[model samples]
Target chain A: MKPIQLQLKQISYSYNGEKQVLKNVNLDISQGEKIAILGANGAGKSTLFTCMNGVITPDSGEIVIEGKKITKKNKIELTKKVAFVFQQPDNQIIAPTVLSEISFGAMNLKLPQEQVLKRVYEAMEYMNLKTFENRTTHTLSGGEKKRVTIADSIVMQPHIYLFDEPTTALDPLHQQMLEEVLEKLSQQGKTILLSTHDVDFAYRFAQRVIVFYKGEIIADDTAETVFCNNKVLSMSNLKQPILLQIQHILMQKGLLKQCNIFAKNIQQFQKLI
Target chain B: MEKHFEQIDYFAYHSPFRKYSAMSKFIFTMTLLLLCLYFNNIAISCYIIVTMLLINVLKNNIKLYDYIVMLSIPFVFVFFGCIAIAIEIHFENHIIIYVTKQTVLKSICVMARTFGAVSILYFFTLSTPIYQMVFVFQKLHIPKILTELMYITYRYLFILIEIQHQIKIAAISRLGYCDIKTSLKTFSSCIANLFILSLKKAQKHYQAMEARCYTGELLFLQEKQYYNKTTTIKATLYILSILLLKIVLRGQAL
Candidate 1:
């Protein structure tokens, strides 16, 4: 079995001592796991991510990365291993130019200059941002800016990647590109976690799904199991993926066999049909 | 109007002068600005203004009309400012306003000096990108706090402008600016809302930065900018010619 990459122990957080945002949350993320967090707005998904990334220290529990407990003294070191891509590219981008923006995190690591530039260029090539090196960050289109922010995190070469609503403002084409980027990261043996409202995307992309509802984890299991749980879906106010809905209807009509595993994407569905 | 603001940055990225070192440009502009003021002569001031404007337009490919429109923003302020210097006011029971020959000439000199200084600064900004200027400032040993403030302020200006644009659109769609009274009320409300929104955005931005491991310093790789000997030589010759022109035109009246 893969070793646990990150473990959260009864973590809870609140803003300004008001309205507990995350309550007694516990999670064990294995290495190279592709997990999608499904939640409504203000469901504590973002708060959980920030807590894991060391941006917000949990009010009550503890977070351990690679068996190393994160504390105030070593928080920076532990945080360097986790990259959090913000939902808004504008807020994440600190530098004016694309080259500097992507290199901001890598440079912060105090790495050699050559290594920093090499990582930046490699990430840019991977993200197809070679031509946009010197372009002003604000002048970029919404999709392009999103890619830059992803590249910014990629340059850090973190072990775990957390994306907060990565597809919120992306168009279909850009969304496809982001899926490819996520696939590449997963293939590189990095743990990936993203919070999203797109159930269809989560259905096709994530191997595991975690549902957050009102500062509590309602469901955490394989995508097939979580989506098949009607209670979890209703509690989170999330609808089942369209493909899963079709599969269920077919099974109810006695046209399809009930199986433990089901097709999660269009290609698999077509083959099954 | 937003297009005009964006065009300044667009041209800076594409301008031929972008290849030159920002430090060199800064020094050159500052020297010319000081000389323009110290000489305080009309011919020298006009010479500085015309040359800077011509170079920006001809080399940078900026449209003459657009450049004038941008410059007119400062021209309005300078014009009104010159009026105060041009006229003399006297109070004897009632107020009396009069213009003397000396005051008129003095106001023209002040106007010339202001235009010369402004044009030289424009040449620098129209060619060098803001980040490059910030890099130069860092190299000059500016306080880290000041540099950080400068950079964030420059970046947030665009974000704030974009938010303002969206808010204005929403207001227009709701008929919030239909009449004078309504427009005044809407404008005040917009300002109030903008302040709150900006604060929220600032906090979010700081959080985002912290997530990336920002401790105290804003660090990034500065690309090496090499100075070209030819550009330096040309800049030097330009300064010499301006000084010679000032000396020869000291007593001349325009």
Candidate 2:
């Protein structure tokens, strides 16, 4: 069995203790696992992500990263292991230029300046943001800012990367760009967990799906199985991924019998056609 | 408001001085300003204003008319502020206003100084981006809180402006501002909503920083550049000439 990279035991949190945002949630993430966290607005997805990234300490829970308990003292060290890319690139990007933005996380790790530069360079190359290194961050378009922010996190070279709704405001081209980066990182054996409301994105990209409904994990399973569960979808206030619905409709009409193909994404759908 | 943003963007990104190191430009600005203040000489002050205008028109390629128009906006405000200094008021049987030679001369000196200072600032700001100016602040050993606050403020200023603009658009779209009374209500509500939204945005920004391993100590990428010795030397010589003019050419009654 693979070693657990991250473990959350009976984790719970509430904003100002007014209402329970997270209610006794438990999750175990393994090495190199790709998870898609889906939930409606106010479902505590952001809060849960904060706990996973060590930003928000759970009120009553234990988070163990690679067998070491996450505490305030070691949270800084844990940051080196878990890199979080916030949803709004404008908020997360503090640097004036792209190069500086990418170097920030690595510099925080107390890495040598040269090593920091090296990491930033490689991250820019990975994200194809090398050309924008000299440009001011605010001058960039929305998609470009998203890439720079992603590169900013990638510089840390963390074992586990958390992205909060990265694809939400991105245009189609930039969304495809993000997908390529994620695929490349996944190939590099990095554990990637992203929170998003786009069920189709999760269906096409994530291997495992975790559905959060009012701060509780209502369903967790492989992508195909989770999407096929109508009860889980309704309970979690999530709809089936568009591709799945298309596949189901085609199957019912006996149109896909010739190809026997149920596609997961546009490419798979094209291949089937 | 959108036009204003576009204009600022023009100066920030497209100014010819954007390429020069901010430290050099800032140093020159400081030197010129100090000389103008220390000597309080009319010629040197006039020289400052002229040089600023020349830089904007010739070096930065800004239209002469545009520079004058922008300068005029502040010119009126400063003019009113300096009116008290310019006029000697005597209240006997009736209100009297007189620009006596001494009083007029005093106000002229003050005007020259004010205009000199404003021009030097424009020279620095029109050329150098705000981020680079912040870098210069970092080099000056300014407080982290000050610079970080400045950086965050600079970052959020545009976002807030954008939010206000969007709210205005939405209000107009929904006929929320169709009438004068409704317009007042809509405007007031927009301002109120902006406060709440801005607070939420600030919180999110802090959380994002934390996620990036920020441990309260703010970090930035410093642009690597060596001081242009020639420019520094020329600027030093220029300041010395101005000082020499103040001392050598003084006592010439106008």
Candidate 3:
């Protein structure tokens, strides 16, 4: 097996100490795994990602990336390994101009000037943000800002990419584009971990799904298995993807023979029908 | 409450004097202000005002009407100052005493000088971006902490204005404007909420900065090539000659 890129062992956290946000969470993400964290609102999905990225420290237990324990001593070095894209694009974007925003993370690393520009241009090209290099960040549309945030993170070239609800507020076309970008990144052997409420997005993009419920992992399995589990689905407050819902209905009616939920292409679904 | 005013972009134009360094502009404006204060001659002060207007026209491309309105802002003070001086003179009840030529001329001179100093500063602001001005301050060895605070304050001024607009709309929606008493209460609460929200935002922004590995030091990465030596020299020479001519011509009157 490939070495584990990220690990959280018996981790727990509380915002105010009166109420715990995450409890006894043990998660291990291998190299290049496309994992999706799913949960209802206030389920601590965001809190978990924050802990993983070292944005928030757990009240107890340990978060280890690779083999080193994450502590204040190595937090800055650890950040270079885990890049986080915040849920709100507006909050994450601090620079006035697009090129400067993209270069922000790289520049923070104190990289050489030429290397910073090179990575910025490459990230811009990768995120298809070359056109808006000189544009003011405030003037860009929601999708454009989202892309800029992604470009900002990707410029760091971190080993593990953590996105908190990356698809939120994006139009359908942009959502599809985001999924494609994530897929391409996963294929390049980057460990992509994203939190989302959208079950369909997780089904399409994530290979493994971890369901969070009121600060605990309720289910951790392959996407197909997790979605097929009614208990996990209800606990997570997640509906099955539309295709899966249609598949189940057809299966019940004997219109389809098998209840196989994993279908990547429309032709496969059509053939199944 | 129209946020989008017609003259919104009035300050966007780079002031011709802005091309010079902030230190140079500061020195020039302060010297001109001192000269205006020292001389109690209406003719000399008027000459300075005319020179300022001509510079504004040639450098900033300001319209004739806009320049006139800009110059008129201080006349209210001039009016009050002249009236006060006249009243002081009228205590003896002499007809000529209340309206002495010297008193009138002195008030007009004071007003012209005040207007001249304001116009020069206005031109300075019009030409320089607020960020660049802050950078100039930093380069002048001003405390980094103070400069950073000023920079953030300047950038967020527009953002806070937008927030105030939203807060007003929210207040109006809650029937805040239905009565004068309620309106006053709503306005006070809005002000309180604005401060609270700004503080919260500042905290969040600080956290975001920490997340991005921001230390206390502010890092600027403008290319060294952006500062053209020849252009700066030419701009300096142009501003100096005009300033020299104004001082030379005005000194001749003394």
Candidate 4:
């Protein structure tokens, strides 16, 4: 098994000492693992992501990245290891122009100007934002702004990324672009944890699925196992991915042979057919 | 408010003079403004105003109507200010108000100076983008906190305006502004809601910044712009002419 890149040990949190938001949740994430955290609204997904990125310290327990426990003194180093992309690009974009916005994080790291510019240009190119370098952040279209936020995260070059509902408010084209970017990041061995309501995207993109129900982890396993588990689905109020439903129906009708490995996406299912 | 802001920003970014170094442009505008203030002479002020007007209209390609509209906003205040200077009121057995030649000349002088100064500012704002000005500020070693605040405030101003626009549209669709009483209530409620929404957004913005490793500094990468020789030469010539015009027209009035 691959070495663990991030470990959350019995983490728990609450807002203003009131109701629990994260209830003694524990998770171990390996390097380059694509994880989709599935949950309904107010299910603690965003809170958990913020905790991991050190934006909000867990009320109890600790988070370790690369064997180093995160602390107030070393939170800056944790920032270097983990990057968080907010759902609202408007909130995340602090700089006036795209070039400056993308370089904001790298510059905060106090990297040399040349290195910062190099990383910014490379990230922009990767995200297809080359033409948008000087465009005002406010003037960009919804999809364009989404890419800018992802590019901003990319310039940080962190090993782990925590994205909060990345696909929310995105058009189909931009969503596809985001998917491609995530795939490339995973290929580059970056650990990714994204909270999303898109079941089909989660099924195709994530190697591991985590179901959060009422501030607790009800299920943690492979996508096939978690999505196929009826109890987990009912408790989390999540529906099966359409592809998964179709696959199950085919098997019930004896139109397809039963196999231990399920196809992750439509292309694979087509090959099976 | 949002439309006006967008139009100015659009012109600033699209202006032909944007190609020049912001430092050079800023220095040119400040020099003209200071000289105009020092001289306080109508000829020199008029010269400055005409030069800026030509640059904005001819070179910057700004529409004449738009330029007039923008200039008129500040001019209205100046005009009202000049009125106070140009006339004197006396209280005796009967109230008396009068305008003298000396007072009229003084008021015209003040008006000229203000127009000249405003024209210089308009040229700078209409031609230089905000990012370029921020770069200039950074180069001048302005305090980081101030520049950071400027950046954040400028970024959010558009967002707040957009929110206000959306709320106004929704209220209109719901007939919330169908009458005077309803309109006043709707406007006040919109202001209240905008305040609360902005505060929440500000908190989220700060958290977002912290998540990206923002310790205390907000750093950005600016494209290095070398001052073009021709542009620098032109700006120098313009500054010298303004000074020469002031010297020639010293103590002169319209």
Candidate 5:
């Protein structure tokens, strides 16, 4: 089996004193796992991602990365292992210029000037932001800003990438581009963990799905199993993709026996039919 | 044609000025301010203003109207000072006439000097980036604590503006513009809400900063290439000539 990349054992946390946001959460992610965190609003998905990235310290239990227990002393080191792409691109972008913003994280690593420039260029190129290296970040469109934030994290080359609702406000085209980027990253053996309410994107991209409801992991299984289970889907405030729903309707009408619910594009949908 | 002029306005050229060293610009403006205090001659102040106007026109290609509007900000203080002194004079304060003349001239001179100072400072800021400015401050051995505060304040200014915009939208959605009294209450509540939102955002930003391995020190990447030597020399000579003219004009007045 692949080496375990991250393991969260009985992790519990709370923003306020009385109410616990996450309780008894146990998850073990191995290398190259593409996991989608599914939840409704106030389901504590953000808190869980924040805890995983060490932005929030758990009240109890342990977080282990590569067999080493994460503590206050090694939190900085863990940052190198896990990179977080925040929900809003504006919050993460500190530099005035695109080039500087992309290079901001690399500068923290204390790398040499040449190395920093090289990595910045590579990241910008990877995100197709090379043309905008000199542009003011504030002047960029929403999709451009999103791509830059992703590029900023990818430049660090972390083993595990955490995306907090990466495609929340993006248009369909931008969302597709993000999905493609995530697919590429997953193919390169990068452990991808993203929390999103976009069930269609999740079904199309994620190999495994974990559902959260009322601050607890309600279900953790493959995409097909999770989408087909009506009970868990209803409780989590989630529905299958539109095509999947249509396919189910056809089956109920005695038009089809079963359907492949993970069709990502029109071509795939055609083949499925 | 108006669009063209607007494009070439003073604020338009501020982008390049933001790249300059803030410490150098700050010291330069402060020195000019001190000199204006020591020399209370209108001729010298006028000379300085003219020089700044010429620089703005020639180097930055700023329009005359834009330049005048920017230069007029300091005169607001002079206008208020003159009014205060006029009021005192009407109260039959004869013994204070000489003092009032001196004060009035000094205020005018201060305003003129401020115009030049603001122009130069604006040029510096419009040309330089904030990171470069912070780096310059750090290299000057300024206290890291103060520089860090400046950095945070600068970053949060935009964030606060965004929050304010959102609050404005929410207020308007709740029919905040229907009447004056209710509008005031809405405005006050919006302001309060903005403060709370800003505080929460600041906390989240702080956590995010720490997650990115921000260890107290605000680090910036140095420019790979040095500034062009010839351009620096030419700009220095241009500024020195203006200084020389101001000194000569003041000496003639004395």
Candidate 6:
């Protein structure tokens, strides 16, 4: 069994003491798990992300990171462990150039200048940011900026990366680039979690699916099981991934093999048939 | 508006001097400016102008017409300012436009001084990239806060310009700028909304910065510049020529 990297216990929160954003949330995320949080807009998905990253303190209950309860005092330390990538890459970019943007997190870790440089180069290599070392952040394309922001977190070498709508505005090609990055991170045994509205992406990229509805976790299971469940999909206002829907239709028409498992992507769909 | 900035940035990146250390360029321009001021000779000023024009046109391969157009506005401003002092309105009808020989001489001196100083500065601006300029300041051990402010301001200037263009295009698409009254309303609203959104974005940006362990200091990274012996020799030759030219003109004036 994998070690528990993060744990949340009975977390509850509200805005202005009247509207509850989260209610009795309990979750245990293991190390190296690629999990996707799926929800409709205003479904407390972002709020839960904030709670995990210590951006918003839950009104009730506590969050445990690596066996220690995170509080106002140790929140800064928690940031070193879990880095939150904001929805808008523009908001997260604090440096003028790409290299400095990546180095900001390393320098903040109190690392030596040499170590900072090493980490920056490594992250740049990993994110392909070397070509944009001197390019100003504002001048980068949407895809490049998103990659730079991801590099900003990668340089910190955090145990877990929290992304809020990481693929929101990226084109198809850049989205695939992000998918490759996620695959690489998971292979390195670094836990990755992202809240996304793309059902297809959630199904293909995430190993585990955590569905949220009306500020509560309605389902947490393997991607196949969670996506196959019609009740959970309806509760979260999510449709089955198009690939899965096509697979069902083809199977029913005897045009495809009667496989027990649903295909996650086009490649898988081709292989299963 | 963003297109204008893109043009400037493109020129800066392609500048012939972009390969050299920003410190070297900074030193050259500043030394020339001081020499011109110290000599207080119009010949020296004109010579400096010619040297800068040579570097910008011949070395950088910048179009002479573009350079002239860029400097024309400032040149006109200085000319009018000098003329304002030159003109002595003794009476309503007896308006003496060119008052005296002394006034004309003083006006010419002032205009030459202003143009010399401005031209050297413009040469620096046209030849140096923004990152290199930041490098010069960073090496001088300027305050981190100030350099960060400079960088952030420089970056967001383009973003704001782009946003202004977007707003203008959106307004024009809807005929918001078709009439004088509508144009006024659209521009006013656009400016007001920009302020509101900028403030909101500023706060969000601070939060995002904090998320990545931002602790006030924005660390600057350096790229390797190939400052070799030949480059050093060339820089020395250029500096010696400028100094020699200034001295020769000063001796002629004496």
Fnat for candidate 1 (0 to 1): 0.69
For model 4, the stretches where C-alpha displacement exceeds 4 angstroms are B247-254
Descending-TM-score candidate ranking: 4, 1, 2, 6, 5, 3
Candidate 4 chain B has its poorest 10 consecutive residues by lDDT at B245-254
The best candidate in terms of TM-score: 4
Off by over 4 Å in 6: A14-18, A254-259, B1-6, B91-97, B226-229, B251-254
TM-score for chain B considered on its own, for each of the candidates: 0.90, 0.90, 0.75, 0.94, 0.74, 0.88
Interface RMSD (Å), every candidate: 1.0, 1.4, 2.7, 0.9, 2.3, 1.8
- Provide the lowest-lDDT 10-residue window in model 5 chain A: A257-266
Report each candidate's C-alpha RMSD, comma-separated, in the order given.
Answer: 2.0, 2.4, 4.1, 1.6, 4.0, 2.5
Q: Tens digit of lDDT per residue, candidate 1, span A1-273?
A: 899989999999999999999999999999999999998899999999999999999999989999999888899866799999999998888788899888889888889999999999999999999999888888899999999999988998999999999999899999999999999999999999999999999999999999999899999999999999999998888999999999989989988888766899989988777
Best by DockQ: 4
Report how far off residue A101 is in candidate 5 (Å).
3.0
Worst 10 residues of 4 chain A by lDDT: A258-267
The residue pairs in collision within model 6 are: none
> Candidate 4 residues B1-254, lDDT tens each?
56777899999988888877899888888887888888778888899899889989999999999999999989999999999999999999999999999999999999999999999999999988887888789889999888888888889998999899999999999999999999999999999999999999999999988988888878888755567898788888988887777677666555
Model 3 lDDT per residue over A1-273, tens place: 889888889999998787999989999889999899999999998888777767677899887888988887787766788888888776676665577678777888899999989998899999998888756565578899899989888888989998999989999999989989998998899999999988888887888999999999999999989988999898777998877888888888888887554574466688776
In the range B1-254, model 1's lDDT, one tens digit per residue, is 76777788888878888878899999998899889888888888899889988888897788888788888989999999999999999999999999999999999999999999999888998989888999889989999899888889878889988998899899989999999999999999998999999898888888888888888789887655669999899889999999899777767765
lDDT of 3 by residue, B1-254 (tens): 12322132234322444445555555556666666666645555666678777776776677777767655656677778766764533445564435676666556666666676676666666555555566668878999999878756654554567678899999899899899999999999999998998887776656555566676665534312144467567556755655565667665543
lDDT of 1 at A18: 97
Q: Could you give candidate 5's per-residue lDDT for residues B151-246 as a string of tens digits?
A: 676566656766777778878888996799988999899889888887777777666666576776666555433445565666567557656766
Taking the candidates in order, what DockQ does each have? Answer: 0.73, 0.64, 0.29, 0.82, 0.40, 0.55
Candidate 3 Cα outliers beyond 4 Å, as residue runs? A130-140, A259-261, A264-273, B1-99, B223-237, B240-244, B247-254
- How big is the positional error of residue B136 in model 5, measured in Å on the Cα after superposition? 2.5
Q: What is the C-alpha lDDT profile of model 6 across A12-113, one tens digit per residue?
A: 999878899899999999999999999999999888887787766889987889999888888887788999888988777877678877888898898988
Model 5 lDDT tens row, A73-111: 887778878899989887777765688778777888888
True contacts kept of 3: 0.12
**TM-score (chain B) of candidate 4:** 0.94
